[model samples]
Target: MKEIVAVLGPGSWGTALSMVLDENQHEVRLWGVDSKQIAEINTEHTNKNYLPETQLSDGIVGYTDLEKAITGATYILFVVPTKAIRSVAKQVAALLDGKTKPVLIHASKGLEQETHKRISVIIEEEISSDLHDGLVVLSGPSHAEEVAKKDITTITAASGTDEIAKKVQKLFINHYFRVYTNSDVIGVELGAALKNIIAVGAGALHGLGYGDNAKAALMTRGLAEISRLGVAFGADPLTFIGLSGVGDLIVTGTSIHSRNWRAGNLLGKKVPLAEVLESMGMVVEGVQTTKAAYELAQQKGIEMPITEAIYRVLYEDADIDEVIRDLMMRDRKAE
Candidate 1:
């Protein structure tokens, strides 16, 4: 089945997914905002800025022009960062043909900074109501680098429409990369964003020389907070117990590959947050997402102590020991 697929973003995850789709025998066009990166991948078939060492698929064509990429796209996979999701969504909307319907698969995580909306929400606002039902959010524990290596990874393809979900599943699922269908859009999106905050918490603990016990405790309690906020946002609680929730938590919290966790690790090691991020050359979503989550919690009256602690540490320059003390001294409650 040769389907035309356009992936919007030239970052590691976008490139890796494009490679996967290419291997699956789909014609893929990789699009990005960065002209140099698009030119590099288009000419050399490699993302030197992101995934430097991995080999890209020959069938994958890279394009910086959004119009060129989305011209004949049947299924569009959005792989851009969360902060840029809306801007890219608007670009996509402008270039979208009113006649040719495309199933939108949102592969990015994190809530919108401006409207506090999810990527799927932004897409729904841009595309026609007819296409709104086709918006899908794809997420899991898979990391971009490992997926680029052809490692076995399982992910979820969630949408309001089962027909669209099936289409996405057929297009993306492979022997090494398995894509399952999920109906819980809020759960999947929330799980993806919330995991980064917990990953930062876990990474901070690791940087502070805490063992697995502390990390596990953070993960469990973090999921509780995640569930609380998610339920407030209309997500099914059980969805948090699935791959996008617990699975993503385990992977991001434990893996050194996670940029959010890595950033927190540096912060724990006594480096300034700005300095750490500047050195990484990549976006550590947790930093921005923490501020967003903190605001949401305050507005919704949600209790997220761990997130607050990280927020204070980042914003107020709170003493780490005192921050830990505040978390530990909280009134005990049932689990």
Candidate 2:
């Protein structure tokens, strides 16, 4: 059963996922803002800037025209940055007017800054119910770099209904790529977003010459905070131990392929956030997520020490060393 799939955003993750669909024998339309990049992808079968040294399948086509990309697609995969989700969804919603509704699937992971809405909520707010059939999220420890090379990877496809989740699971699951279905959308999304904050802390510890023992401790404690905040927001605590939770936290925190980890590594070396952003030339989602999470925690009266410390480093220009010392000096408590 071949279908048309529209994947928005030409970042590494989006491009890699497009390849997966292509391999699955589906028609894939990859949409990007830059005409030049689209041209490069279509003409050269490669996205040099994002997935360097990887060749995209010829079955995948790149499009700059939003309407043309999704006009007749049966599935829409949103992979843009969290900050851009709302604007992009609005455009897609307009394009979807008077057309058959498509299954809406998003792989982006982050919460809205001030509003603190999950990605699905943001999309639902902008896109009319008449124009979309369902909302599903794909998340896990999978990295684009590895997935591009056909390395083994597993992820979760979560939606309100089992039918929707299973639809996505079927489209993506194949040899070397496994998909699991879950009904806990809130937990899955939170696990995907919150883990990046911890990953930043993990990278900072590494940049500051911390050993595996310290990194392990940071990740363990980070999961606890993530679960606490997630539970406060109606997410299942058990989801934290699953792929989207601990699984995502482990890879994002430790892998050099993670943009968030790389950003934190630079910050650990005392690099300015602006400079780090300029150098990376990609979205460091964790930086913004830290602010949103910190605000949300304060508003909800949830105690998240690591998130608070990372927020101070990112927003308040607090010294990383001093923040670390303060975190260490906090009164001891049972785990």
Candidate 3:
């Protein structure tokens, strides 16, 4: 069945997602804030800024106007970063006929820096939750590059509503992409957001000349820290052990293609945060996610040593060498 899918954002991830849906035979309207990118997608079907040679489909209509993108979109794939999610949602809210709009499927992974709010909370605030015909999270270990190439990608479509999650699971699961249905929305989201924080640590470890053993150790420890925080936030403890949790952690923490990992690598190489961000050319959710996670950990009194260490490395200008030394010599406690 062909569905009307609107992809908001034109970054690598967004363009990749839009291309996937278009190949799935859905009418995809890929909206971009970058005028040049939009022009390229419209005329040349290429967004070189993110995807260098991947040409989009005729079914994928690239537009700049908010109204033009959401006019009749049945399901919106919100692919913007955590910071831009709310603002973009607000713009969509103003342009949408709230009484009849598409199911807003958040494809982002991170808590908002300002309120530590999830993407769904922002949607509820921007548009009434009661009016949310469907609210779902699409996340996993899959990267935009792999998905764009039609590689076998597996992700979860989690929602409170069983029917909606199943409906969503069907739309995304194709020959190359597989979607699993899960009801643990909180766990799924928490896992997705938390992985990026740890990926930075992994990248930093790599930057410090750490090998696979170090990456594995950081990934496992990061999972524990994230699972602890997720359980504190009322998420299913087991979800942290599942696809959205450990699966995503392994992928992002190890992959150089991961923006968060690359950013951390840059930081480890003595590049300033500002310079690293500017060079990345796209929003690294982990940068802002670190702030939110630090806030959450502080508020909940959760002892997230890794998260705190990363926070300090990012914001407080704490030397990575000093931080690693402290982590290695921390107060001894049972694992």
Candidate 4:
């Protein structure tokens, strides 16, 4: 069934997802704050600054007005950064009609910096239940750059309710983009957010001229750390092995397309955090996620050495080399 999908953000990921909706024959209303980018999307059918070298589908209309983009939409997809999710959700809630309840789906992956709340939680808190159908989290190993080019990408659309998850799956499932459904929203959201922290560590390993063996160790240990913290939060342990878990960890940790990985690579070279962020010209979510995860792990009494090492380096101004050394020198324990 054709539906009006309002994609909020208009960043690379949002635009790429919009392309998928366009291919599915849906009316895509892409909303963003930047007038120039919105105008470019409307007129030139391109968003070079974000998704460079990729031409967007002409059918994907861009809108600067929040109300105009989502007034009649059946689904509202939030792709904004973690920091902006609450603010954006509030804005959407204010403009949405009381009688209209669109299915709320978020592709953004990260816990809120201040509250350490998942994207879905923040959205639900901001948007009244009467104003939306249900909340679903769409996440996996898919990158915006690859998805923009129609590369074969598989992901998970997860919701507490199976029906809601399946609804999202049907809309995005097609050639080159496969969508799977999962009932574990907690696991899905955690895996999606926690992997970014490890990706930064993996990139740092590469930046430090470490061999594949070192990266493998870091990622392996990183997964265990992620799973430990996740389970503490009441997430299904099995979900950590699925697409949003180890799969997402691999892609984000290894791919150059990951902003977190790129940021980590720069950090590994001993570059200052502020300068690295300024140079990237994009949100390095892991930088903020690391702090939240670190604090959360501590609060939960979860043993997450890798997360702690990255946290120390990111937040405490610790030497990367010394942190790595301390991590390696920790007492032996069962694998």
lDDT by candidate, in order shown: 0.87, 0.94, 0.87, 0.94
| Model 1 misplaced stretches (Cα beyond 4 Å) | 130-133
lDDT of 2 by residue, 1-335 (tens): 99999999999999999989998999999999999999999999999999998998889999999999999899999999999999999999988965678999999999998899999999999998888889999999999999999999999999998999999999999998999999999999999999999989998998888999989999999999999999999999999999999999999999999999999899888889899889989898898899999999999999999999999999899999999999999998988
Q: Where is the poorest 10-residue window by lDDT in model 3?
A: 123-132
lDDT for 217 in candidate 2 is 90
Question: Could you report the Cα RMSD, in angstroms, for every candidate shown?
Answer: 1.3, 0.8, 1.2, 0.7
- Each candidate structure's TM-score, on Cα atoms with residue i matched to residue i, is 0.97, 0.99, 0.97, 0.99
Q: Among all windows of ten consecutive residues in candidate 4, which has the lowest summed lDDT?
A: 92-101
Residue-wise lDDT of candidate 1 within 1-335, one digit each (tens)? Answer: 89999998888888889988998999999887778877777677788788989878668888877898888788888888888877777888887757787888889889878578877888787776564337888999989899998899999999988888988999989989999999999999999998899898888898999898888899999999999999999999999999999999888989988988898888888888879989989888888888888999999999999999999999899987789888988999887
Each candidate: how many clashes?
0, 0, 0, 0
- Model 4 regions lying over 4 Å from their true place: none
* Backbone-clash count (model 4): 0
Kindly list the per-residue Cα lDDT of model 4 for residues 100-190, writing each as its tens digit: 7899999999999879999999999999999999999999999999999999999999999899999999999899999999999999999
Q: Alpha carbon lDDT of residue 4, candidate 1? A: 94
- Name model 2 segments beyond 4 Å from true: none
lDDT of 2 at 49: 98
